[model samples]
Target: MRYAYDAQSGQCLKFVYRGYQGNGNGFDSKEECEDQCARSLYDFA
Candidate 1:
């Protein structure tokens, strides 16, 4: 399983990875995706 960040919903969603290609866009877990992308959504100034 793997997670992808949804820019519209601002959340990390999980799905099965059927193939073995590579890119920096995939996240191993919801927490990891949230840490990198969603953090900006919740940050307080």
Candidate 2:
């Protein structure tokens, strides 16, 4: 499992899981995860 957080607020923004069960979000790479987090921040702003 992996988590992405907001730099300023230090709050969790995303959660990614890598397993056979496939239960949570998953990103191809860390860069992709950060990109998604950035998009979500802007989307709510």
Candidate 3:
């Protein structure tokens, strides 16, 4: 499983990783995704 960042929702969500590839959005632990992606959204808000 993995997590990805949703741009419209601005959140890190979980999902199953299929095969062997990278989604290129925010594939990582939810905490990492939030720390690296989602949380920053609130900084400007």
Candidate 4:
């Protein structure tokens, strides 16, 4: 899996195993962006 996030706008996405990627935009803060991605990835463990 690969993840890419926009640091400026806080848009983020996760791409997995040749499937269609997911994306989001317009976060209120950087902490929110990091938190969202961390939570999403945490389930993989």
What's the TM-score of every candidate structure? 0.66, 0.46, 0.63, 0.41
Model 1 agreement with the true structure over 1-45: per-residue lDDT tens digits:
988888787678987877688566588888898797766666753
Best by TM-score: 1
Q: Model 3: per-residue lDDT, tens digit, 3-42? A: 8888888678888887576657646588888777845677
Give me the displacement of residue 23 in model 4, in angstroms.
4.3
What are the per-residue Cα lDDT tens digits for candidate 2 across 1-45? 465555687454555464667533356556766777778879999
Each prediction's number of clashing residue pairs: 0, 0, 0, 0
Off by over 4 Å in 3: 39-45
Clashing pairs in 3: none
- By summed lDDT, the worst window of 10 consecutive residues in model 1 runs over 36-45
| CA lDDT of every candidate | 0.78, 0.60, 0.75, 0.55
**Can you rank all candidates by TM-score, best first?**
1, 3, 2, 4
Candidates 1 and 3, the one with greater TM-score: 1
Q: Cα miss at 45, model 1 (Å)?
A: 9.8
* Candidate 1: clashing residue pairs, number: 0
Clash pairs, model 4 backbone: none
Sort by lDDT, top down from the best: 1, 3, 2, 4
